[model samples]
Target chain A: MHYTVKTAGDQSIIIYFGEQISKQTSQTVQKLSNIIESSGIIGVEEVILGYTTILIHYAPTRISFHTLINTIKAIIMDVDLAKTDERNTIEIPVLYGEELGPDLANVARLNNLSEQEVIKLHTEPDYTVYFLGFSPGFPFLGGLDERIATPRLENPRKKVQAGSVGIANHQTGIYPVTSPGGWQIIGHTPIPLFNPSDDNPFLLSPGDIITFKPITKIEYDEIINSQI
Target chain B: MIHIFNVIKPGLLTTVQDLGRKGYQKYGLSVSGAVDYYAHRIANILVGNQDNAATLEVTMIGPTLKVLETRKIAITGADLTPYVNNSPVPLWRSFTVSEGDILSFQGYRSGCRAYIAVAGGLDVEETLGSKSTDLISEIGGHHGRRLIKGDTITANAVHTNKICLSRRLSTELIPTYTKHVRVRIILGPQDDAFTAKGIETFLSSEYTVTKDSNRMGCRLEGPTIEHKNGADILSEGMFMGAIQVPQNGQPILFLSGRPSVGGYTKIGGVITVDLPKVAQLKPNDRVSIEKVTLDEAHELLYKQENIFKLLQASIGEGGGL
Candidate 1:
């Protein structure tokens, strides 16, 4: 993958993979991120992975910008371009509609479909977790069905509950923490994407494949109770 | 051994902070630490603690504490009229407190936040290698929330009778807090997204800090900076001190609790040395932004860091008053 390096700040630099978002780009970005992370290169403070970029925050005291870029360039030369199906396919259980997911009704009304029809379409696709952002373990997933796409709320809510499954345009995501958000929520998931106490903390990662499985409210309660 | 302090009144907003939680931004974690890094560092230095020792970050108002044991403590950054048993104490110096001394703060004199560092650092359990509190995430530092009344703080009690007591920082090393501040910035990765007029307006105009400002970020009210095209850009990683101009044209300056990534076009980043000043800005405070080369930013940082080196030698030679 051809990339361009640009200065993000005085101590940080960004490496761009491509203009468009694709699984291939995420693969390349993740590949380089893993290599550099495990490489234990000096001066590297933090390596943040984006959909189509990698941002490296380094200490200028330990290594110069030119030296850091040169080191990345050499590592990129030996990167594997072949795409492998090593991504994890995790199925998430969700309870659709009702109070927790107030916007589900609006989504169906906007698409001129029944609530059951919307649920059917929502569960069909094996969505790709493009990246983790917005909050900890909050995955910005790709591959939402366009037929049920809904726009965001005009005025954002004061606090959207955690575990809220929302849709904005063609994208869908889960809220790991309760924050002021404008996304049109369609459902609630029993499984938390973020658990700060866990060893991994974040349940999803870039390139992981996830599919939403519809479940009853009782089932959701059971899962939640079991986890506790 | 550990020294304990009971919170009689938690004041406006107070939390434990250190340098910040690093290497966790990849999981979208916000680094919620001391906004005034320089002050936090100096407070720790004055009390002979490591740079990353967790300290209490007191906001506009300050907390009232009942000291439970004799320990060395230093207050730095904002002047919040701290008092011990109704008598005023000095800032930027370490002193011994009696077991029952009433440590309290009266009013804000200058700056926005103050750091109180005890000799042995706070003994809070680290969540993800940090004692800093992230209020939004509700993790780390006294249960990831601001200090409340009746809350008790436990600190490691190290004997520091020789090195730190009565050691006041030299006059030249302290920063002056003012209503208006000139902040230096380094233009960066997305500067071209803004128009020449937009860049010119941004540089020329004076902005007022809005009331919505916090540890997360401050929204600036100023001239609308026009973008060359649209205001939105492809989502990418963001950092502290990033001046991101949104669709409304007003710039939002992210601080210590900035999100890991953003989609807005950032015009520039506040220089590292100037970040301490940025953290001290109060609501409605006026700010003038100036540009400097990256080399100058790095040089200023080195110059600021050299103060610690000089202080270490000076303290080692003379010990203290």
Candidate 2:
């Protein structure tokens, strides 16, 4: 449960759990983040949780850096790491191959498997959401089956469409918005991953479990049209 | 009550901004806000609006707007040589704009950005509790994008008698933007990952802001900072003013519209009080970093806050005459 606190800027401090990424370390990071966030620490504006760290942004006018550090340290000493919180398991419907997944054939060839087999392996295991980053509501997912793991495209596409499910090396994720990326695309989802107009903007959050459910292109079109 | 203005011409990049959206970075949401926060606050204060009231943030160029109704307004930050009805108006002061008066800006003058605050804040719908525009996500401010020609933006009706007229900030309080700027910083969440010589190079070298620089970050080209091992690190939460160095060793100073986290190594972070100076810098402007202690940075912020409070009190006593 040992951790180091470092100053991020005049108003923020980063609490580092460990140097490497591991589930145990991530759990510890999340546990401490929950305590600090729910503790009602005065002047704490936001508590952002990373894979192996947590950044706390505070208002200096209400609490000084020295006081904030001491308060956080005291909270850390009293936190119970064994406690686990209940989380949701979200199912994301995706359409694999064809125009939606432009890189699926390439990924299958690189992994020495058929496109169908690649989709099977990708959807088999439930992946853990490491954190949300790179783009809005984009989840950095872990637990990609090593059998279908492949490298990213050498030259990234100039613009990747929103809802693209992509894989790069051992990691896999979804592009929540239209952005430039280098991941190997295997499928596309019709469900809006992010909508700022909605009450809850993000579809998934850190600590949630995700499983990809293969759907037909007709179903994807139906979902898209129904939303309109 | 409706208060609107017709956009004659949209300058380079004009968008509505406030203090910024908070409590959403955990979901990977960016805290997009005013680039020059000091100037934003001062402009709002001069017009007798709340400090966090949304104001139009004008970039290198300024927009041309025709007042649809008579309203009190104030212009602050980089002097873009604003003109109202073909007559020059002063900077950092509050004045009334009559209906049908056309307000426009000349070419580049001194600074890189300016702020225009109405007596009542702009009445844009808030997204995630903020009116500031997140350019990348296209989700806040007016239609979640920059203002364009022919767009009309509405402002809340002013119902109070506290509207200020011809209220100007003192000459000493005004900031002068120069080609060469020195900003203070507090070294590292990753300073230990750099070689001592690399830190020295960063503190001593005069870096030129590249043309590609934007509200997200200030890209610098100068001496490369030597790393002890490599530049890549596990992606982690980032803050405003973070100086991140990538594989090329060039530093990119993250600003108001930066992403929530990054993988590059951060050598240091600039003091919050000095961010306005960085915001005023234009492309090709030379910048050097000066190291300071964390306590000193905190003290400087406190001092600035105190000055603002005193100024507000004085204005109340003088009745903004």
Best by lDDT: 2
Q: What is the lDDT of residue A97 in candidate 1?
A: 94
Which tens-of-lDDT digit does each residue in B1-321 have in candidate 1?
A: 375689999999999999898988888888788998899988887777787899999999999999998887899999999999989998988887888999999988999999999888998989888999998899999988999999889998685554345677888778899999999988877889889999999999999999999998978998999888887776788888899998888988889888888888889889888998999999989999999987788777777767766665564343452
Q: TM-score of B chain for each model?
A: 0.96, 0.97
In model 1, which runs have C-alpha deviations exceeding 4 angstroms? A83-85, B1-3, B160-164, B309-321
Q: Which sections of candidate 2 miss by over 4 Å?
A: B314-321
TM-score for every candidate vs. truth?
A: 0.96, 0.98
Tens-digit lDDT track for model 2 on B257-303? 99998998999999999999999988999999999999999999999
Q: Which ten residues in a row have the lowest lDDT in candidate 2 chain B?
A: B312-321
What tens digits encode model 2's per-residue C-alpha lDDT throughout A1-228? 678989887888899988888877877877778788888989999888788989899989889888898999899888877888787899999999889899999999998999999999999998888788777898988788998888889999999999999999989999999999999988999999899999998998888899999999889999889999
Q: Residue B142 CA error for candidate 1 (Å)?
A: 1.1
Q: How close is candidate 2 to the true structure, as a TM-score?
A: 0.98
Q: Which candidate leads in TM-score?
A: 2
